[model samples]
Target: MRITADRTRCVGSGLCAERLPDVFDQDDDALVLLCADEVPAGLRQDVEEAVQRCPTEALSLDADAPEH
Candidate 1:
């Protein structure tokens, strides 16, 4: 799966980072940062959870897309 975030829609809530630190993080300004755009199979489930928990719906996953 591939994941991306829309910064304009983010609220700096940090929930994604909290739920999946290995794939998400907060910059110095506390904006959401994607640590891994091309998710490995092992981390797909956790990444999906993070996307679902995003309050502002800033996180997105393209599960059907071909891996880059």
Candidate 2:
């Protein structure tokens, strides 16, 4: 799956980073940043949880997209 973040909608709640630090992080301004554009096979579940738990709905996954 491919993960994408909408920075404009991020509230910097840190939930995404807290749920999956390997794939999400907070910038100096406390905005959400994607650590990896492509989700790692082992971290798909964590990514999904992060997306689901994102209060602002800023995190999204494109499961049907072709892998690069």
Candidate 3:
């Protein structure tokens, strides 16, 4: 899995970082940064939640396996 942020679309909501700090980080602009691409060993749920909470739809995850 790979997580990335579309800076062009990010609204600086920080929702992803607040909800999943382990996976998401924010730049000075408040846009979330991807801590890693692959979904960590056991943080799938958190990642999903973050994606869902992204106000600007800027946070996106690409998983080798469909989200389960």
Candidate 4:
């Protein structure tokens, strides 16, 4: 799956980063930062959870997208 984060929509909740450090992180300003553009096969579930748990709806996952 492909993971996208809208930095502008981020509220710096750190939920995504805290739950999936491998795929998400916080910048110096604490806004959401994507550690990877594509989600690994094994981490799809975790990425989906992060997207849903994002307080500001800044995270998105495209399961139909082709892998890089």
RMSD of each: 1.3, 1.0, 3.6, 1.3
lDDT tens digits, residue span 1-68, model 2: 78999999999999988888889999998899998999988988888888999999999999899866
Candidate 4's error at 17, in angstroms?
Answer: 0.4
Model 1: per-residue Cα lDDT over 1-68, one tens digit each = 78899988988999998888888889888889988888766887788888899999999998798844
Candidate 1 vs candidate 2: the TM-score winner is 2
- TM-score winner: 2
**lDDT score at residue 25, model 3, on the 0-100 scale:** 88
Clashes in model 4: which pairs? none
Give a tens-digit lDDT track for model 4, residues 31-66. Answer: 988889998769988888889988888999887897
Please identify which of the two predictions, 2 or 4, would achieve the higher TM-score against the true structure.
2
Report the Cα lDDT for candidate 2.
Answer: 0.90
Better of 2 and 4 by lDDT: 2
**Superior candidate under lDDT, 1 versus 3:** 1
Q: Rank the candidates by TM-score, best first.
A: 2, 4, 1, 3
Per-prediction TM-score to the true structure, in the order listed: 0.87, 0.91, 0.83, 0.89
Candidate 2 segments whose C-alpha is farther than 4 A from its true place: none
- How many pairs of residues collide in each model? 0, 0, 2, 0
Error of 2 at 20 (Å): 1.0
Candidate 4's error at 6, in angstroms? 0.5
Clashing pairs in 2: none
